[model samples]
Target: MFYTTIFVIVPPFFLWRKKMKTEHLLEFVNVSMAFDDRQLFQNFNLTVDSNEVVGLTGQSGSGKSTLLRIAVDLVTPQSGEVYALDRPVKDWDPRELRRNVILVLQESQMFPNTVRDNLTWGLKIHGESIDDEALLKILEEVQLSSLDLDDDAFNLSGGEKQRIAIARAMMMNPKALLLDEPTAALDTESAIAVEEVLDELIKTHQIGILIVTHNVEQARRFTSRVVDIHAGSG
Candidate 1:
């Protein structure tokens, strides 16, 4: 008699982690970048690991935001390298790189569409889809559960917009998230609300987060490590 058998397989992460270095999710090695006629940073190095929150704090124009931009290939360094998930950022296509290492800037963009459309737009660009159940779950995770999917997304306050920006990044199932002063514009109450959502994200997920904040206290509050940018604030 012959016996029948089946094989089942499961992958832990979308990106291949076999060759990853000690759970490192994002890395900058000997990188150098500069603004017009003014050098911003040189020979800088940093890392963000899985299930970790790394903070960057410094005065304005200290190249903190520039580091976040370089991670996803938005701004390429004149020297050295930036890696995401063990692969050089230059090796990944721009859209694909941005998806894996999501960047949520201070003044996040809001489309004229509804909240549902704003949430799904990134996936649509990638030719992907998420059901209503999943969308609702992400909303709750970002502490915007009170928001209606069909509501005008442009009407949200600064804090709400920042959280939605994070939700938009979360929609991509990113391995790393880069935040440039995510709570800079919000009131104390608003900032705390956003931080609550971030605390939950850290508690429940294996992703890495790098936040740029002028407030060292805020950074210390949420991040596993806080890095102070020394580049002269231009």
Candidate 2:
């Protein structure tokens, strides 16, 4: 009788452990946030997992961007829990956490240096380096072979800068990538090029993606699941 009880209890316990290990890369549980007099969302639930692309869509003030901010601790929610890499968001250092889970904004921020410095800066943050050959390959992947590594990053157009920002994030090899209107500023050809790179990341690295897009067609094409924050439920 004792052995039978032990066998039944042990299997379920181990199964629970396995389930926990597969938790979302970033998860918002009953999260709530507000700014000034406006309430952004309540009881919001979202899960971003490895090997999956999740789309986030809503109107301008629906707080889609804020959800991304909260994941990396940029903005704190008034209430609810946030988990990153299966641990509570507060458990990890903000900078270290951001390194593993990177966010690329719509409007890119340029470093005051050459494009080489911009791309290498990602590796430098982790005390690693990439040679010129590999750097050029990454550039070519993003359709910027024409731009020299020595070219000033600040001089690039808004759309070009966006691509650079994405390439920079790729250098870091984050476990999860949050992109906010990533291709909004690009032309049709450039947009498709960026999508190809993202698809590669998904297939090769099993990286989770949380993409916030206004274009319904883009959400359908890029994501396996879509969540509207205003609807306020999974």
Candidate 3:
């Protein structure tokens, strides 16, 4: 009786482990998209695993930002499929999907309110109560722990505002973060600071990250693997 139970439990446990090992956090399979008369992408394929950071680099209008949007379901491909957490994107609830796969845009959009208000906005929208501890942790993770909760969010500098925006997304506890030129607008020092925070977040949270950057050096420094999009590629 004991041997039979052990065999049944151990076999299923190993199978589950194998399944997890084989699945990606986000995947795009043979994706194709076009805008107006321009074909931006054709049969593009990419995968992001939970343990690695992937960078997208290309010239302007190469569809790097569009790819990130597709991962978050903000944009639909003309053909092919996007998978998140081993399931098709269509199978996810939109709100839940956004929470799990947060996208941080290049420009920081702030509410005309206090930092506390902006931080809690997503939680309120998702019907979850604000946890002060979690909020503080996220702030620290994004290198903005010095700012008071009641401080005016719109009064910060461009780089500070960017950090705050990243903190807001981190508050949601996403499984993956899709960043569109996260450090593009910042000065050298500020950009380096933000990159440090991003590196720490990936290590500490064990979440996958896909970053789109026009700077080849930045892409090489920040990500484990880089994907270059071209005009004619299948």
Which is the leading candidate under lDDT?
2
Report lDDT per candidate. 0.82, 0.87, 0.85
Task: Return the lDDT, model 1, position 10.
Answer: 26
- Decoy 2 TM-score against native: 0.86
Please state every model's RMSD to the true fold in angstroms.
7.1, 3.4, 4.0
Q: How are the candidates ranked when ordered by TM-score, highest leading?
A: 3, 1, 2
Best of the two (1, 2) by TM-score = 1
Error of 1 at 81 (Å): 1.6
Residues 85-163 of candidate 1 have per-residue lDDT tens digits of 8789999989989888888887888876888998998999989888989999999999889999998999998888888
Off by over 4 Å in 3: 1-19, 231-234
Instruction: Name the top TM-score candidate.
Output: 3
Per-residue lDDT of candidate 2, residues 1-234 (tens digit): 999999999999998899787888988899998998899888999888898888888889989999999999999999999999888888899878898899999888999799999999978877998899988987876778999999999999877888898789877878999999998877767777777778876877789999998878788777899999977765
Report the lDDT of model 2 for residue 167. 81
lDDT order, best first, reads 2, 3, 1
How much is 74 displaced in model 1, in angstroms?
A: 1.1
Candidate 3 similarity to native, TM-score = 0.88
